[model samples]
Target: MGFINDLAAKFTFRPGRGRKEQNGLLAEELAALAKKIERLAREQYKANILAEQSISMIHEQRAGLREEIRAGAIRELAMGLAGDLLPIIDGILACLDFAGENESLRAGLRSVLDRAEVALARYGITPIEALGGKFNPSLHNAVEVVEVSDLPPEIVLKEITRGYRLGEAVIRYSEVAVSKSQTGTVWPGME
Candidate 1:
């Protein structure tokens, strides 16, 4: 009789009661839904990880570029300061030239000048060649003209005052005496 009642209940429909088979089916559906949610969560977690890595890479690149720019700016600032100090260097050179050629004094002056020259050379300050070269109106100022037979026309015979330069830019023009050929020299359009 017990077995018959159990079998009857399996085939019978109950209206207002919890059934074992229905509970099992509902639990199975909930478990399947939970697995789907877990899969989606895993995908989202991986995506977030990738995005974080990308952001970190971008930040590192930006930091490297920033450092390069800073280095470049510092180098440019150093060069500009050196350029401003050129005139002061020229003053030092002039002092050395003006001092008399006493051995002890000259030795002391030469030592100081040599050090300054090395520093200036590192910073691109160079002496302009003026004597016995072709006179460039741009770099040499003709304070006087003299007739000479040995030199070519318009050549620099003497540099009255030395000139200094910073790289390609002339800080001061060389004060010079330009030579005119003795025989061929004539006034403009007087030939």
Candidate 2:
């Protein structure tokens, strides 16, 4: 009887003590789980911030690439148009050279040249100043060298074929005759 009563007491559920102990264990487990969840959330937030930064960088690069492509296409189109107009101008100039002494023909050719210049100006195409200017490799191609005692060496004495440019871009280089001094050095102003 005594052993049975002791066993019953040991196995018996005391609501106050048993429930409090179980609740404390449950609370500790819940706190641990909550801390783990919070840590994961913080890590995920940092990852998201890094991802957004990467995406922004990619977008900037893409925009810059698009701008470069657009500029290149514009340059190409301008060059193509200039290519078509240059030969016509050259032919007209040649005719003008041959039409000398015929006042009427010279006047007609002069009017045509004026009109062509105006049309080119409207499209941002302008003749590169070559004659009397210092010869630049970028804008001038020296086909002939003339030894001159009066003028500075490397000076452009004459433009054989005119150069044209659209905005800062040179479409064609001027074929020019440059002066060479007796000493064989470039002009003073030229580097």
Instruction: Compare the candidates by lDDT and give the number of the best one.
Output: 2
Over 43-110, each residue of candidate 2 has an lDDT whose tens digit, in order, gives 99999999999999999999999999997887777677778888999999788879969999999998
RMSD of 2: 10.2
lDDT of 1 by residue, 97-187 (tens): 6777667876887787678667766756666898889899889999999988766678898777767666787766888899887986565
Q: Residue 176 lDDT in model 1?
A: 88
Q: What is the C-alpha lDDT of each candidate?
A: 0.76, 0.85
Question: Looking at candidate 1, what is the lDDT of residue 144?
Answer: 95
Count clashing pairs, candidate 1.
0
Q: Which portions of model 2 show Cα errors greater than 4 Å?
A: 1-33, 147-155, 179-191
Which 10 successive residues of model 1 have the least lDDT summed? 3-12
The CA-based lDDT of model 1 is what? 0.76
